[model samples]
Target: MIVYEVFRQERKGQAFAHAGSVGAPDAAFAEAYAREQYGRRGESVALWVVPREAVAEIHEFVDELQKNYHRVDGYPLKEKLKEARERAGTAPPADR
Candidate 1:
C-alpha cells in the first residue's frame, strides 16, 4: 500500500490545506479514498492526493551570513526625509 498525503480546499477561492493521509494500492484508489475521507460531506471543494514518498522533506534552512539590506527597515528613509525637508525649507535642520 502507498501512503498518500491529502490536501483539501474548503470552498471555492479558498486555499487548500493538509487534510490527512490515506493508504491505497494505486493512484486511483488513493484518489477515491482521499475524496471519501476528506470531501464526502461536501466540506471540501477540491482535493489533491500525492504519494507520501514523492514529497520532499526539508528540515532546515540556513543563512550563512546575516543580510539586512533586503528588509524595508534596512533603508534609512528618516534621514533622507529629514534632508529633503531641510532642502525644501519646510523645517530647519535639527541642531544635532
Candidate 2:
C-alpha cells in the first residue's frame, strides 16, 4: 500500500491545511480514502491527496542578502511614533 498525504480546505477561497495521511493501494484509492476520511462529515470542502513519494522536503533556505523588512524589528516603529508625536506637539515631557 502507498501512503498518501492529505490536504484539506474547510471552505471556498481558504487555504488548504494538512489534514493527515492515508494508506491506499493506488491513486484512485488514495483520493477515495481522502474524501471518505476528511470530507464525508462536511469537515472539509475540498481535499488534495498526493502520494507520499511525490512530496519533497525542503531543508535549507538561502537568504544571502539578509532581508529584514518582513520582521517586526526591521521597522523602528517606536522611534517613528515618538518623532511623530514630537512634531505634532503632543509628546510627553522627556523626564516623564
TM-score of each: 0.71, 0.74
User: Per-residue CA lDDT of candidate 2, range 1-96, in tens?
Assistant: 999999999999999999999999999999888989999999988888988899999999887877878777788889899999999999998896
Q: For model 1, what is the alpha-carbon lDDT of residue 40? A: 86
- Per-residue lDDT value at 77 in model 2: 89
lDDT score, candidate 2, position 13: 97
For candidate 2, the 10 contiguous residues with the lowest summed lDDT are 63-72
Per candidate, the number of residue pairs that clash is: 0, 0
Itemize residue pairs with steric clashes in candidate 1.
none
lDDT of 1 by residue, 1-96 (tens): 999999999989999899889999999999999888998899998998999999899998665565668778779899998888988999764575
Q: In angstroms, how far off is 60's CA in candidate 2?
A: 3.8
Instruction: Choose the strongest candidate by lDDT.
Output: 2
* Candidate 1 overall lDDT versus native: 0.89
